[model samples]
Target chain A: MLAFVLRRLVQSLLVMFFVALLAFSMFRFLGDPIAQMVGQDTSLQERERLRVELGLNDPVPVQFARYVAGVLKGEFGISYRIGRPVDELIAERLPATLELSFVAALFALLAGIPMGVYTGLYPDRWLSKVLLSLSLMGIALPTFLIGILLILIFGVNLGLLPTFGRGEVVHIGFWSTGFLTISGLKSLIMPAITLGMFQLALIMRLVRSEMLEVLRTDFIKFARARGLSNRAVYFGHALKNTLVPVITITGLQIGSIIAFAIITESVFQWPGMGLLFIQAIQFVDIPVMSTYLILIAFFFVVINLTVDLLYYAVDPRLRVHGGAGGK
Target chain B: MNGMENNVAAPVADTAPALLEVRSLRVEFPTRRGTLVAVDDVSFSLRAGEILGVVGESGAGKSMTGTAIIGLLEPPGRIAGGEILLEGRRIDNLDYERMRRIRGKEIGAIFQDPLTSLNPLYTVGRQLVETIRTHLTMTEAQARRHALDMLKEVGIPAAEERIDHYPHQFSGGMRQRVVIALALCAGPKLVIADEPTTALDVSIQAQIITLLKRLCRDHGTAVMLVTHDMGVIAEAADRVAVMYAGRLVEIGPAQAVIRDAHHPYTRGLMGSIPTIGRDVERLEQIDGSMPRLDAIPPGCAFNPRCRQRFGRCEREKPSLIGQGDRAVACWLHEQGEGAS
Candidate 1:
């Protein structure tokens, strides 16, 4: 098991290396950062002096080496637009995005699984049909459209909740969380639902189809023949069998939730790394944009590694060696 | 169809009450086209400690009858008529929960492919323990010990160690042994072994059949062994039931049926088996396939395929005519008695 983990770690490092290389190219390929950072009135000598001090005048390889070294130490340089360390800016926005994504993920899992199981167990029931149809719309509708429609219904028309931004955050150490406040939670509902909608539908459909397939397998019939209760047959036998695929999809989807949170963040004006990344892009802020790219890639690699390990644990067939112990 | 009167006169295990009795049992699958009868008025009895081989061509509803007895018929296929009784208790119409209680406790099942029968995620020992505990009032430790004993009983080497291994770790034959162990662990009075050796290797098939027969005999568990292999039936079954296109064409003592197959379909089946020294160019083959559920011909289902099919055989379905320990559902037998 230790060897298995180490091997995955090495693979993850290799993937992160490639992403870092891609991020490094953005620095050289994108337009000059000095032009964007300095004013028109600044003298050519001042600009040249600033460029040298920032190591922009150095060879591309030397600059890339410096950037890689800074990334290794969790430093992503100063944002051209903000004039602050890119990591610090990310740190300030990280908590909100993490909280929002976590809540959205939790909601999707809690609701999607049961609905999937229900629809799977009774594919022809009236309630199952309705739930299935609703899930289709959930997958079909765009995130922004759903967000706007929800804002119109509950925010603009009903006047029941806030439509944009994280509300009433309380700071504890470096982490500022909206969980401690009611306004924060109330403001969270719309965005969390919007972000989770597509994933919830996807999880539901995958789970439902997988459940249907698992139920038809011979082991399930053998389980029933053993006179196991319906609960054991459906949940213990069929549900567990469906979980391997469910876990795979959910893991990949969680990565996407964090990466593609840009649209959701934009619609709600939620202050998070995604919004920061978008602002960085608009200003051609190389440090923040490249760092964000590398960070998202890191999430994907870590999640993929975690997923690979989870399969080994969940499915014995994937384990490298047969167990030597007995019950 | 008059099976109830002969319930007390089961050929084997004389004086023992019938362990399982099916009277006019009919299984149907309701499709959009119409109601397709899969098992039509199939009636038979299994005596305690007796092995009844339900032999037939594929699609003859041999598996269906076994599946029906265990109450595991897949959806849309249901026992549309008739009844099934176990030791005088009516079980065909019991509620789902009640039937589930009877399953694994009163009746266990061993299916064809052992590879797919056991859940892959769980160890073989865990599966056996769960089944044991479900039907027997045993603690976890007791169940585990019992499971080990079962694995050992099924001839699995290193039972103490291999018990923790998953199903895939074992070969096809060993897996079937584990399946038999699971089915018999709870000491179910009757076992429905549906095509148990069909999915095994040729060499492994004989071993599995022998294991099943020995286990069932030792435990005094009656078995309705469903299979299409006459060779397997000859080796393992004490009594034989011949089915064709969802109807019982012939049923009697296994030896008697193999020696003097009264029905033309049964004769055809027996002739199809090749002898070791025979120099024939080709072995005997049945003329036609079993009819589909939706298109089974009227009267006798086997008429289209029977070389000896007569006019009346095509007009009127023949019920089992002989009495006592033997019977044949054919127009020739019916007419022979009528003429005599």
Candidate 2:
């Protein structure tokens, strides 16, 4: 088992290396970052000075080595437009995004699975038909449209939740009494729903279809023949087999969520890395944009690796060797 | 048709009652075209400790009869008319939950294909323990011990060690043996083995058939053996029920049915078997096929295939008739004074 985890860790590093290289090259090699950063008003000598100062005149290999060394030392360099440390800016905005994204995923898992289970178990029933149809419509609707609709319903008309932004972070030593982080959670509800609604639908449909297929397998019949209750046959025998696909799709969807966060963050004006990424891009901030891209790629690869390991644990067919004892 | 009229006839005794009595059992399906009758007025009785072999060609409703008895038939097909009495208790059309309890407890089943019967993910021991646990309220250790004993009884080597092995680890014959162990784990009174050896090789087939017969005899359990092999019926069955076109044309003692078949269809079936010590010109093949459920022949279903067909055969269907030990379904036998 230790060997298995070590092997996975090694593969994850390889994946991250390629991702970081791509992020570095896409911003550094192909595009003229210094020309764009210096703008049209700079004199020829001024442009040369700026290029040398930013290490653009150095060889590509030297630049990459410096970038890797800086990354390893926890220094992401200064943003070209803001003239502040990228690490501090990201640190200030990171918590809200993490909380919102995690909450959205939690909501999706809690809501989508039951709906999928019900639809899969009773395909021809009226409730199943209605849920299936609604899920289809949900996937078709865009995040912005859904966000606007939610703001209109709950924010403007119902006057319940705040439409956007985070409340103050109260501090009492290390812990706060008015952890209105919980209250901030309320403000994030509408945008999180908009971000997670399509994923819920996509996940539900995949789960429902996969579960329907698993229900027809021989093991399920064997379980039924044992005279186990319907609930046992479904949740016990069928559900375990259906989980591999669900884990796979859910893992891949996290990558899509990172991509979707750009739009969601802009729509709701939530202070997060996605909004930071858009602002940096608009201002031609090479260091900030490269760091964001590499971080997103790193998250995607790490999430997929965790899911792959989980899949191996759950399915004996994919186990490293003979399972249990196989490292 | 005249071969099995005299030897080992069936006797109706007032003293011994049938442990499982099925009378006028009919199963039908509502297809898009019309109602299709799958089992038409099939009747048979089985006493405790007796092995009754049901023989027929494909699409003869043999498996359907087994499914109906176990209450496992899928939707669109249902019992149209029947009385399935187990220990004098009516069981036909019983509620699902009630039937489910009786299925693996009172009446266990071993299907033909062992590859598809057992769950691929679970170990054979796990399945055995599960079945035992469901039927009997035993502790996990108790169930495990019982399962190990059963695996040993079924002649599996290293039963304790192999209990943890998955289904894919065993060979076909070994898997079938595991299935038999599962079916017999509850000590069921009646075992429904539907073509249990049909999927096995010739050598393993004989071994499985002998094992089943020996197990039933020792436990005093009745077996409803469904197979198309007449040779197997002669070896393992106490009585034989011959079916064609979803109807029972002849049923009697195994010896009588093998040696002196009464119905034309039965005679054709016996004639088709290749005797080891005897040489014949050619094996007789039953002419034509069993009629489709939707397009059954006008009157008698076998009239088109029967070589002894007469003018009256086209106008009337035959029903089982007898008062003594044996019953035969044929117009020729009906004419005789003591033919049954």
Candidate 3:
């Protein structure tokens, strides 16, 4: 297990390195950062002085090495557009994004699993059919549209919740979160639901189908034959069996949820990394944009690694194989 | 030559109360086309401590009958009309909750494919212990001890150590033994074993059969042993019922069923068994496959395949006619047909 984790850690680092390399090269090709910094009216000597300060005159290899060295020291350069340290800017926005993603994931799991299990257990029932169609709509509609619909219903028509922005953020040392206040929480609801809708639908459908398949397995029949209560057979045997696939999809969907949050965050105007990403894109803030790309890539790698480890924990077959591989 | 027959044919009085009884049980699968009667008018009784072997080809409704008996039939297939009685109390119409209570406590089921029968996620000991606790009101410690004893009873080596192991850790035969132990753990009055040895190797098949027979005997549990193997029926069963196309063709004492079968289907089944001393061009083959549920013939289901099929065999279905302790569902057994 230790060896397996170590191997995954090494792989994660290599993946991050490649992601950094790709993002750096791509940003370099997308136009000069110096042009964006000084603007069209800036004099030539001023531009050269700015380039020298930013070490742009150095060769590509030397620049990349410096960037890698700086990254290793937790320095991600500076956002030319905002004139702020890239890491500090991202750090300020990370918590809101984390908060929104966390709530969305929590909502998806809490609502999706039970709904999926219900629909699976009673596939023929009218309620399940309704839920199935509703979930289909949830998956079919785009995130921004869902976000607009949610704001239209709850924010505009009902007047029950706040429409946009993180209302009030509470700071604890370097970290900040919006869940500490009622208005902030209410503001979070619309964006979270919009962001999580697709994930909820995906999870529900995955779980429902996987559950339908698992419930038909011989072990479940054997479980029922053993005189286990319907609850035990469904929850204990069938549900546990369904988790491997469900968890795999859920893990993959986390990356997607973060990706979709970009749109959802824009739709609600929630102040998060997604909003930062958009602004960074408009102004050609290469350092900020690259950092965001690398950070999200890092998140994907780490999430996938965690999912693999979780698979080892949940499935004995995988554990045995993992053990053999370690040997 | 027939010494083993004597041991199995210990006659019981006709009046002995049956542990499990199915009366005119009909299981149907309703489809868009029409309802397919998977099990049609099947009636049988299992007495206490009796091993009743139900033998047939695949799709003979042998497994269907067993599943119906245990109230574990999959959806769309249900008991359209029937009365299942356990010790004279009707249980077929009971709700799922009540039926569940009676299942592990009164009747146990062992299915084919032992690998699929045991949950892979849990330890074998946990599975055994949970089943024990579900029916019996045993404490956790007591259940654990009982589970350990069951593992040992099923011939699992190192029961104490191996109990923690998952289903995949055991070989196929050993897994079946665990399934057997799980089925019999609560000491239910009756066990329904559906093709228990069909998934096992030929060499390992006999061992499992013997273990099942011996364990049930020790517990005085009546067994409805459903299988397609005639050899298993011959060796393990006290009584044998031959079924074809969702109906029982013949049922009698095992010795008589094997040696003096009245139904042509049963006789054909007996003849198909290759004997070491006898040599022939090829083993006897039943002429045709068992009919699909939708296409079962109007008269006797076996008429198309039977060499002895007569004019009446195609005109009318034959009901089981009792002759002493045995019954045969064929026109040949009718009073005017032949008494010789």
Q: Which candidate order results from sorting by TM-score in descending order?
A: 3, 1, 2
Tens digits of per-residue lDDT for model 3, A1-327: 899889989998999888888877776667777876776889999999998998888887677789889899999998889888999999999999989999999999999999999999999999999999999999899989988888899889999988899998889999997879888888889899988888898889988998999988999989999999888899999999999988889999898788667898899898899999998887778788878988998899989998998888888977664221111
Off by over 4 Å in 2: A1-10, A28-44, A57-66, A72-75, A85-88, A168-180, A320-327, B1-14, B323-325, B336-340
- List candidate 3 segments past 4 Å from native: A57-59, A321-327, B1-13, B336-340
TM-score of chain B of each: 0.94, 0.94, 0.94
Sequence-dependent TM-score of model 3: 0.95
Off by over 4 Å in 1: A24-35, A40-62, A320-327, B1-15, B277-281, B335-340
Local error of candidate 1 at A148, Å?
2.2
TM-score of 2: 0.89
lDDT of 2 by residue, A166-274 (tens): 5555655533222266766677788778888888998889889988998877556655655666776788678777888899998888777766688888888887888
Interface Cα RMSD, each model:
4.2, 5.3, 4.6
Better of 2 and 3 by lDDT: 3
Candidate with the larger lDDT of 1 and 3:
1
Candidate 3 per-residue lDDT over residues B166-274, each given as its tens digit:
8888888989999998998998999999999999889999999999999998999999999999999999999998888998878889997898888888888988999
**Which candidate tops TM-score?**
3
RMSD of each: 3.0, 4.6, 4.6
Best by DockQ: 3
Per-prediction DockQ, in order? Answer: 0.51, 0.31, 0.54
Minimal lDDT window, size 10, model 1 chain A: A318-327
